[model samples]
Target: MFRNARLSLFLPFLVCVCANGAALAQSLPQPASQNGISYITGGVGEDEVQAFRAAAPGYNLRMTFASKTGSYLSDIDVTITSGAGRSVLSVRTEGPFLFVRLPAGRYQIGAQTRHITETRKIQVPAHGGADLRFYWEDPDRHGVMRVCKSCPDTARP
Candidate 1:
């Protein structure tokens, strides 16, 4: 009787948890196709990120965008080209993750943000997938001069 009572108490909680997880997964962005290439991009929140990670294995090419300091980046313009230089897929990512179903071959990926672009070449295996990460230097940490109003500037020879 004790075991049956415990099982009954746990079942409803399990069901609710499973239902909520399913609903969250369903809320993720749907896969899209362009020029016969299928892809999905989005990972704006924890739930969406988890959903993307769960779906990633089904894709042949998985990409992630971030800064050198490890902050996630979005609104990246992504372009993938075949080894022969033919454009296969081009789209702007809505979040930090982009998953693509591509044929087994060599491809070049270009991700652009804030007018700066980074390129990478990758190979997709015949059976599994490839993961690519693109990291950009944080703008605030580089190329910007900080000035102190109260400190006198020393002239350099």
Candidate 2:
């Protein structure tokens, strides 16, 4: 009887803690699905970056966007196509990080910003994830576009 009373007393506190945790998780950015592919995009702030890092393990593809100078970037239009030429996911990212869960296969990722588009081909392993980075040239302070010297021939506009 005493043990039952102890568990009863602890149950309400456990419930409250679990409820608060669920609420907090709900308030964070949630994954969206398209064509059976699930993805989440956002890393605008430190807390959000941490959240994305914590969730990265569950995703099979992780992408990061930045400028040639290494500053993080956002507002990129992204599309992922399967090796069989089927469109898997297409969305405009609101932040610098994109995490996707994909089957083991080859894929093409296209990212566009400031009227410049770059494409990359990647193979997702069966047991682990693939990480891809897309870099764009930073516009001049006067807002004029400049050539990216270090960009590959394919990435050049």
Candidate 3:
């Protein structure tokens, strides 16, 4: 009888925890699909951004967009193409951050806003990953572009 009472008391707590967990899970961002490419694309909120960053490593590339003054920018166009110039991933994120899964290879990553387009070359390791950051400056305020450490930009076309 005592054991039964203990379980009965714990049951309410368990139910409450499970219900809260389900709600939180539902609030998390879900993977999106565009042009047959499946990607995780949301980080507008504080918690959602944390979740996105936490889940980033599993993806092949983490693309982030920001202004020249270091302000986060959203809805920027991002495109990933193979070394042979084939489109691999093309997406426009609602937030400043986007995570995509690509096969290990060399590719060109292009990020564009209304007035500027920044391009970088990246080579995903056969066993590791990479990060691409686009800092968009104004037309006249443009400066040197930064390349990913893992991938070298040997040639610019």
Candidate 4:
């Protein structure tokens, strides 16, 4: 009888803990699927940034877009194609950053915003990953648009 009472009390506490954990997990960013590709694209909030950082290494391609003035850009369309020119994944970034997982190989990445469209060729190694930065300069300013495959990460705004 005493053991039964103990379990009954402990069960309530365990239920509460499990319920809280579920809520916390829901609050974190989750991956999205499109065109048979599963990717997570967000950097708007602290939670999203943390989620990207934690998952980026597992992905072969990590990307971010910005203006020549160093302002982050969003709502950009990104496309990834294999070395043979077959489209692998196409996604639109909701924030400045986009993270994607692909089979280890060579790919051409293309990013397009209202201001400019840029393309880059990159090789995904057998392990680890790479970062790419697309600088979508303002056309009015006559600045050159460029993509930096090895650019350093700037301070998160």
Encode model 4's per-residue lDDT on 1-157: one tens digit a residue.
9999999999999999888666545544577776666677768776566656666776777898888888777899999998998888888888988887777888999899884789999998878888999997653445433368586534323
Off by over 4 Å in 1: 145-157
lDDT of 3 by residue, 44-70 (tens): 777676677667877878888888778
Report how far off residue 78 is in candidate 1 (Å).
0.6
* Candidates arranged by TM-score, highest first: 1, 2, 3, 4
Q: lDDT values of the candidates?
A: 0.90, 0.87, 0.78, 0.78
Q: Which numbered prediction scores highest in lDDT against the true structure? A: 1
Report the poorest 10 consecutive residues by lDDT, candidate 4: 137-146
Model 1 TM-score, all chains together: 0.85
Candidate 1, position 83, lDDT: 98
- Locate the minimum summed-lDDT window of 10 residues in model 3: 137-146
Clashing pairs in 4: none
Which ten residues in a row are the worst by lDDT in model 2?
137-146
Model 4, residue 93: distance off in Å is 0.8
Q: Where does model 3 exceed 4 Å of error?
A: 1-24, 34-36, 138-157
Alpha-carbon shift of residue 9 in model 2 (angstroms): 22
Among the numbered candidates, top TM-score falls to: 1
lDDT of 2 by residue, 51-102 (tens): 7877889998999999988889999999999999999999999899999999
Candidates' TM-scores?
Answer: 0.85, 0.74, 0.69, 0.68
Candidate 2 regions off by >4 Å?
A: 1-27, 140-157
Alpha carbon lDDT at 26, candidate 3: 62
**Can you tell me which runs of candidate 4 are displaced by over 4 Å?**
1-28, 138-157
